[model samples]
Target: MIQATELRLGNYVNLNDGSEHDKIRQISGIEHKIVYTLIKGCRFAQVHQSFDRIYPIPLTEEIIIKCGFERSEYNDYRHPILFGTLTLYEGVAELHISDMYSVWVNNLHQLQNLYFALTGEELEVKI
Candidate 1:
C-alpha cells in the first residue's frame, strides 16, 4: 500500500477489496485531500476524497499466472505472446511476465479486468 501523494496517473490500485482493481486515471487536490479521476464504464471514478489504503498491483510472473497465462508459452523469447487488455484475462488462471509474451497493463483495474474477462466473474479471493 502507498499514500495518495505517491499515486501515479497510471498506477493500479484496489481501493476496496483486493479483488476489485481500479486505475488511477487522474489526481487532484493536495496531500490527504487528493481527488481521483473516474470515467464511465470503470468500476470506480471521480473521488472527492482519498482512500485509506490503495493497493498497487505488482506485475510479476506469479500475478500473470494467477491471471491465467500458461507457463509453457514462456519458453521462447523471440516468438513470445503479446496479450492485449481484452484477451489477457481469459484462457488460463495462471500467468506471469514472459520473454515470449508482453503482458500489458497501465492501471490497477487491469487485474480485475483480466479476472473478469477470463472468468466472466467478479474478481475475488478465498479467505
Candidate 2:
C-alpha cells in the first residue's frame, strides 16, 4: 500500500486489482488523499480508485532505463536544468547530483518528487 500524500501528479504506481498481474499506471490526479489514475488500453479511461489499490513501483534498473537515463552513465544533460547520475548499489537506487549531493530513492513516486523538487518540472516517464 502506498500513501496518497507521498505521491504527486505524474508519478507512476502499480494498480493492484487483486490479481497476480500488476498494472502500472501513471497518476493523473490526487485529491483529499484519493488517487486518480488514467487506465491505458484500447481507449483512455479515467478511474478514481481507492488508495489500497495503489502500490509503489519499486526502483529498479529497468525503471531507470525506462525514464530515459542510461545505465552506468552519468547523465548531465543541460547541466543546470536536470543532471544526475543514477546508480543501483546493492539493489538500492542512488541518485548522485554531484560529488557531495545524493539521495536514496526507493520508489518511483519518490524519484518523481525529488526530480520535481530540484528541476521545478515534471520528469517525463516512459511507461
Steric collisions counted per model: 16, 0
C-alpha RMSD between model 1 and the true structure: 10.6
| Per-residue alpha-carbon lDDT of candidate 2 for residues 1-127, written as tens digits (9 for 90 to 100) | 9987788878889998788998998888888757888887624677788898899999777777666666544432222345767777555677778899988988888988988899888877788
Provide C-alpha RMSD values for all models, in order: 10.6, 3.1
**Candidate 2, TM-score vs. the true structure?**
0.83
Q: Could you give candidate 1's per-residue lDDT for residues 83-127 as a string of tens digits? A: 432223332223333445545554334555554555566544211
